[model samples]
Target: MLNTFSLVGINMGGLKISLLGSLMCIAVLPACVGLKPSVEEQVNARIEAYWQAMIQKDYEKAHGFLSPGFRLKVDKFVYRNRFAGKTSYKAAAVDGLSCEEERCQAAMILEYTVHGVPPYGFEFNRTEERKELWVNVEGEWWLLPKK
Candidate 1:
């Protein structure tokens, strides 16, 4: 037979546990909310950084943006060589980006000056639009290899 005082103490203990649990959730919930940038923003930022690295001829840094699967398929040497001696762009912009779950696609526009041969020598500005694929792996976004 439990005494009245003992029953009251047990009830208080349960109440204290419940109160502590609720307080813990209250303290932790906000920190988990809005702690990271949205997926679209993150993808766009990563793409921007990749283009910047390329423009600066930092092949090693640009290679870091490639997806793990892509990197596995194509080593850094091959990746760098592909872009070596490529046409240089005067400006680049990420026109738009859309994300769905773990995958994202971005549209980019690059502006460059095309130089003609000496005989027909003429310089003209050209713009090209490209679609890029990206994937999110373990919370970090990476660009997929070009097909």
Candidate 2:
């Protein structure tokens, strides 16, 4: 039987086939490209923000970036008491900072002179310092204790 709903030179059977193919292509289009931001980019931004804040000694700013459990583990007062007052020893530079998924760690090289009295006198020294490890939880990151 000949159908009246034919497309151009093609018969009805071919027209139905072409329509189905077009529909399938449209359905699969979204899977071919991404619309959301990449996880790696998000993680890297978090790491940079944390690093900058720490270097600036903006403890509150840095603390705001931490995960909830970590924030509770040590309050603002404790953080200030532990790190705020101490003067920087100087000659320290961040050697490396890397992050993988929810975890990050950094290394620093410190160069200074050890001051001594009497026998030892003052001497120059250089050493590599390692910062504590950090972890992310529920989209927030925090520094873990050194072991």
Best by lDDT: 1
Candidate 1 structure, TM-score to reference: 0.66
* Candidate 1: residue 125 lDDT (0-100): 59
TM-score of model 2 (CA atoms): 0.47
Q: How many clashes (backbone N, Cα, C below 3 Å) per candidate?
A: 0, 0
Q: Rate the local accuracy (lDDT) of all candidates.
A: 0.63, 0.48
Query: lDDT by residue for model 2 over 4-64, one digit each (tens)?
Result: 1111111222123223422443455332255443443343345445545654667777677
Write down the RMSD of all candidates, one decimal each.
20.7, 22.3
lDDT score for residue 67 of model 1: 95
Which residue runs does candidate 1 get wrong by more than 4 Å? Answer: 1-34, 113-125
Off by over 4 Å in 2: 1-40, 89-101, 108-128
- TM-score for all predictions? 0.66, 0.47
